[model samples]
Target chain A: MAQASGKSAGKSFFGKFGVHIAVLIFVVIWTIPTLGILVSSLRDKDQIIASGWWNSFSSSTQTEAGRLPGPEAQVEKDGRFVIEGNIFGDGPARTISAFGVRSATPTQFQAGQAADLGDGVTLQLNPDGTFVLSSPVAIEGRGQRVYYASSAPPRFTTENYETVLFSEGIGRSFINSLTVTVPATIIPIMIAAFAAYALAWMRFPGRALIIATIIGLLVVPLQMTLIPLLQLYNGVALFFGVPSKTYLGIWLAHTGFGLPFAIYLLRSYMAGLPKELMESARIDGASDFEIFLKIVLPLSFPVLASFAIFQFLWVWNDLLVAIVFLGSGSDQLVLTGKLNALLGSRGGDWEILTTSAFVTIIVPLIVFFSLQRYFVRGLLAGSVKGG
Target chain B: MADLTLRQIKKAYGAINILHGIDLDIQSGEFVVFVGPSGCGKSTLLRTIAGLEEITSGELKIAGELVNDVPPSKRGIAMVFQSYALYPHMTVYDNMAFGMKIARENKAEIDRRVKQAADILQLTKYLDRLPKAMSGGQRQRVAIGRAIVRNPRVFLFDEPLSNLDAALRVATRIEIAKLKESMPNTTMIYVTHDQVEAMTLADRIVVLKDGRVEQVGTPMELYHHPGNLFVAQFIGSPAMNIVPATVEKTGASTTISITGGRKAEVPVATPADAAGAAISFGVRPEDLRIATGDSVLFEGRIDYIEQLGEVQLVYLDIGRPDTPLVVKLPGNSELKRDQLLKVDADPATLHIFNAKGRSFARDHAPALAA
Candidate 1:
């Protein structure tokens, strides 16, 4: 028995270690892209192109070209002709670590040292961008072309966010997304909650058939309804003399698409509630509506919260619904649509794309984190009794 | 307060019948408890009276007003559920006040009633706590308090104490009894599988089996004179023991011959035709005692003994191998297994059931009459 237990204990120790390793790998896999996008979006656009986002914290080295002062500006000092200038011309300074007369050996000459440029000419560049070019003969040409290796300090800025939000139209699309998502999330929940309560508690003929139909509808793919729903909306719009692609149209579309699952989820939860509660409420003289509003709604909070999170995330992150039901103009473009547009137009502009992606996910992240307790509770609502 | 009259209340789901034509008249202010085994439809009957379940065909009158088609709230009834059913998110105060608030009662009246109910249930300190934060007993009290604030004419409790632990069940049962006493004018109907609760807390107990009432009487009346075999076995702990016998003689005192050729006379009236009829001799385990007199009813080898500290159960093999005659003896009584022992009961306490499991009417034994 002791030996068996010892072996089992050893196996469990390794099992636990294996689980930790798997969790760590999962965490890394999930966090790396988000971390990369955040780091890339904050980086200088040039640095983002120069190297990966992983290297954004470290200084980047680049070989740059600058011109020395022309002979016309030469000054004779100590009986020698001299040309002087700074390598960085009135911009943010970069340290000139090394300079070379020839491009092939840019780093051969260290800073603060004079180098022979053949024919009795010498050039010295300081780390602070100050350069001195002196010649035994007066300099005759426009400034000699110089190549030097300079190291720029790491740059972090909100410029990418500003560009994405203001110029890239993500900020506008954000409001548009909220406009579509909030009403879409809320309308379905309202309709589904009432339907769920009725189906669960109220008595009516063909109730079972209605519940079965909803469950059947749950399996019907959303893609199958797109064209028919669009045509229906257009016909309605023509009849009502309103625009077809209005927020109201998309909100209704989403509500229609979301209702089946929402009702299915909520009805199951509502049905699972102790029958005595509804009976007690009824005995207390509450009307069906009153009981639904007072008892069923309050007790169904966990399932409601769970469904809200699901619907909110689905609506907020939806691209297909937005593109189909909403016009792609600046006025109606939602965040997902805007992100898709950015992906196409700024295909190589990682900075803008990353920034826009981060902006689009921020609200969902905030929502998920803030309501995670309810989300977990909602997910586990009917899986366990009284949980 | 109102009297509830249920006339031929029959509920059926297609062909499966539940509550087979239940007819019960609940007098105003009477505390009646429905006691039955599982699936006996006690809860269903209570729900029917609460107006939660529609009766398929019946006339229900509350205070002499036909309320068969009335909605539950309009029926002037409040129910405490077995699972408490307190709203999980609501504070005890709000939970108790919910009905009044829904009725749009005056705010001060709601407050007064809620506070009064809370005080009655000793829940004043926990009024602000949510149901989930309170213990099971406390939640049940909140449920009761919710019912109280409505001030309904009839109160219904559907196995309200069943959810609690043993000790808490007793405590809550007593609280319910007291609550019923305090609200004497309000008719209350309680349902429970626990006979002790029915015996202790009810003015009268209605024993149901298979969707029909087997007997309706006071606790002692049901205990001393069960109408049928089912109620006899169902009401008492460890159940009453039954021994098959042949009726040897029929009179004011019927004599039956047992399996082991022991003939005993039981004080029950039987007709002349009952002679030689197959019958069941009933005796409660608690009523049987070790016989010290010459008139030993039967002798049997002790099979086993269960020592419960206060009382010991002695199982005896009286010729029937499958059915053991269980005798309840005093705790200090010492008996050995496989030893033959004689047991007897007073003829007045003995019961004789006819072939159809109906108990014959009992007559006062000569000794008791004298």
Candidate 2:
């Protein structure tokens, strides 16, 4: 018996270790891209393109050609015509790593070296980008073209966030998304909670049939119904003489799409609650509504919070329903729509793209972290009695 | 005053009948306990009285009003469930106050009643604690406190102590007994499969079997005179020993011949038609003792003995190995296994049941006559 227990202990140790390893793997895989987007979004716009985000901590190097001031600025000194200037010319300071006359061999000469030009014209570039070009007689008309590699110190800033939030229309879209998603998430939860409580505990003639129908509706693809749903919405809007493309329209659309699963999940959870509790409450002089509001609702928090997270994340990240129901105008565009537009318009601007994407996900991250304690608890609620 | 009348109450689910036809009358302020084995519909009967379960066909009257169609809350009843069923998320104070709040009582009155109940159940210290924070016995008290805050006329308990541990069950059982003493005017119907709880706590015990009431009497009456074989075996531990016997004579004092060729006379009167009839002779193990004089009930060999602290249960093989007779003897007795022994019981304590398993004791209904 001891040996058997010892063997099982060994097996359990391996099993636990394996589970931890798998969890670590998943965390790393999910975190790396998010971390990259965050780092890239905070970097200076120029440095964002200069190097990968992994190299954002250190300096970035790039080679460029700059022309000295045309020979008009030359002077005679000790029988030599000399042209002296800073290669960077009062721009951002950079360390000149190497300099060359031709682009093909941009870094052929090290910094602080003078290259022999073979016509008694020697050029020198210092590490701080100061350079001098000298000739034995009068200089020529055109200035010298110097190709040099310069390294800029690493730069991090919130300028990308500022630009995206202020100028790129994302801030407005963020408010719009909140307007759509908060109601969309909340309205369905309220409606479905009532429906689920009725379907679970109240004995009505069609309760089982309604529950079955909702479960069946869970399989009907939202994609298949989106067009018909929008058509129906438009028909209703025309009848009511209301605008078709509005935040209310998108909110209702998301709620409609989210209700079937909400009802199904919440009903199953509410039904699994001990029947004795309802009976006890009934004996305590509570009506059906009172029992639901006071007892079942409180006990159903884990499931309710979990469903809120699911619906909030879903509606917040949704682009299709937002597009079809609401207009592409600035007032109705949600975060996902705004992020899509930014992706197309700012395709080459990693700073803008990363910043917008990060903004879009920040709400969901805060929501998930705040309510995530209930997420796993909700899923595991009905698996055990009185858990 | 709250008196419950259940007449021909039948509860069935589609075709499966859980309760056949139950008739019971509980007086005002009576502590009535329904004791039965598992699947005997004791809990169902309690729920029906609480109006939680609709009676399929019957008239249920609570406080002299028909409540068959009334909702549970309006029935003037409150039930404590086996699981305590205290709202898990509510504090003990809030749990007790919930019903009154739903009824929209004044806040001061609700406070007064809740605090009073909390004081009664010794729950004043735990009023702020949630049900999950309290121990099992404390949770049961909170449940009772919740019921009391409702101030229901009829209090129903569906095996309230079954969820508790053994020591806690005993302590809580005493607490419930004291609660009953203090109330004095609230009708309480408790249901349990534990006969010990039924015996110690009930003012009147209602024994049920297969959805029918077997017998209803005081504890001593049921112990001394069970109406049928089921109650006879069910009411006592180490159940009464019954040996097949043939009636040799029938009269006010009847004589029965046992299977082992011994004749014992019982004090129960039987009809003349019972002569020479096959019957069951029963003797409680506690009633049997070692015979000293010439009158011996059975001569047997001691087969085994279980030594309890104060008493020993000796199994005797009186020429019937399959049906050994168990006799309770003093624990300090010098007795050896496989030794010859003769045991006897008083003639008045002997029981005779007819072939139909009906007790023939004439004095069984004396309480009814009074």
Candidate 3:
């Protein structure tokens, strides 16, 4: 036994060391992309457009080398019009790579040099926005493209969020998502918790058949019932003079869809609670509802919180259910539906998509991390220790 | 408090019979215990009285109210469970106060009752602590206090101290005895498989076997004049020794012949037709003693010696008996293994049972009736 224990100790030490190595690898893999999105959101638009986010560690490029008009206002001296200008804007010039006159060939000339154009027009382009032009003709069409290497300013702004919230109609979707999520999460929990207590503890007829039917509902596809559910809601709404696609309709839809899993999870958890405890409560003169509210609810807070998180996140991030149950308007579009619209309309704007996507995920992330402890605690409660 | 009466209470679950018909009546303030082996339906009987389980076909009356169809909450009874089921989320004070709070009693009355219960259980200092924070013994007291706060006319305890450690079991058993004494008007029905608890705590014990009452009496009464062999064996440790015998003679005083042709007269009542019939003779281990050189009852070879710090029990291979005959000697006795020892006993301690395991004596035999 001692020899076997010695071998096991050696194996365990190496096993733990291997686990540390695996965790480090996992952390690196998970963190890099989130960091990329965060960093890409901070840099200025020009810098982001000019260089890849992976290259964000180094300085960005801005072309410099300005031109001046030729001497055309004075008396015609050597039959030339002249102008003078510098390359840089009001900002400081940091590096000069190449300059150009044509738009397609923007990086054609060097800074602080004279380039001969073959017809008495020797243009001297300085690093700053000061240059001399011999022709002195009007500059038209597109102006000279001054290309240089200038460091982009470290820019971080909430302008994208402001624009999305106020102008792009996502603010309404945010409120609409909350409208769907809170009631959807709460309604199912209240109903499911009662169902779970009855299924777990109460002696009644057809309990096994009810529980089995609920488990069967858990595996049924939401798509199969979507049309019928929508028709049911519409028929009821028409009778009540309510809108066909109101928040109540969608909340009810999500609640119905989320109920099977919620009831199954909570019933399993409540059933695992020691039967002795409930019998003790019964002997203490508590009714079924009294025991449920007083004993089962307090003991079931962890599982309740876990299921709340699950249903809340699912409803918050849901697109298919929202589309089926609601109209195509800003007033009822949830964050996920709004984001899908943004994908098609604002396809070229990475900043818009990333900012809106991040905003949509932010609520779920908060809900998950805040209630993660309850998730672990409730899962542990239903499996081993009590059962 | 008033007496509890159970008339032919039987329990069966869907074609599987758990408890056969049972009947008993307990006087007011009596600490009656139901003692039995495992799966013997003793706990079932206690639950039926508590209204946690319905009696299948019998009437159970608490304080003269037939509560067969009444709910547990409306039955006006409280129970302390085997697991000491205190609410895990509530403090000791809140746990004791929960039923009263639900009843909507005035705050002052609830507080007065809770404080009184806590004081009785000596749990005032730990009122603010949750049950999980308390030790096993402390939690059990809180469970009892919860029942005490209900202030029912009858208390049902379902193996309340079985979850305790040995030392705690003894201490809590004594506390329960003291609790019973304190509440002289509250009739308590306790159920336990531990005979020591029944022996030390009950005013009257109901020993049950196979869902029927085996015997019911005071501890000493049952010890001396058990009605059957089952009680004869169950009532004491190292159970009463039995050997086959024949009724050699019968009269107002019955005489029996041992297997080896030795005759003895027992002060018992038997029918005249019992002579020449087979019977079994029983005697307690402590009742038998070593025989002197001239004394005679039976003779045997010493087979084993077990010295239990306070007593030495000698096992003798009296050949005619189906098992080894054991005799318990006082602590200072000088008996050794393999010693051929002759054993004798006071004839009054001799217990003779008929062939059907029925004891052949009145309810209180001469051992105590003297």
Best candidate, lDDT: 2
lDDT scores in order = 0.88, 0.90, 0.82
Root-mean-square deviation per candidate: 2.8, 2.3, 4.1
How much of the real interface does each model capture, measured as fnat?
0.87, 0.92, 0.58
TM-scores for every candidate against the unseen true structure: 0.94, 0.96, 0.89
DockQ of each: 0.73, 0.86, 0.52
Q: Considering the two chains of model 2, state its CAPRI-style docking category.
A: high
Residue-by-residue lDDT tens digits, candidate 3, B1-370: 8799899999988897777888899999999989989888998888888777777898888778898998887777888988887889999999999888878899999999999999999999999999989999999999999999999888989999889999999999999999999899999989998888888989999999988898998877778888889888888888898888999888877889987767777878788899898999898999888877565677788888888979988888888555888788897898777778887888778889999999986535544854
Q: After superposition, how far is residue B122 of candidate 3 from its true place, in Å?
A: 1.6
- For model 3, residues A217-271, the per-residue Cα lDDT tens digits are 9989999998888788879888999888888888788888989999998998998
Off by over 4 Å in 3: A1-10, A52-58, A61-86, A91-146, A238-241, B258-264, B296-298, B320-322, B363-370
Clashing pairs in 2: none
Writing each residue's lDDT as its tens digit, candidate 2 over B212-273 gives 99999988888888888888899988899999999998888888999899999887788899
Better of 2 and 3 by TM-score: 2
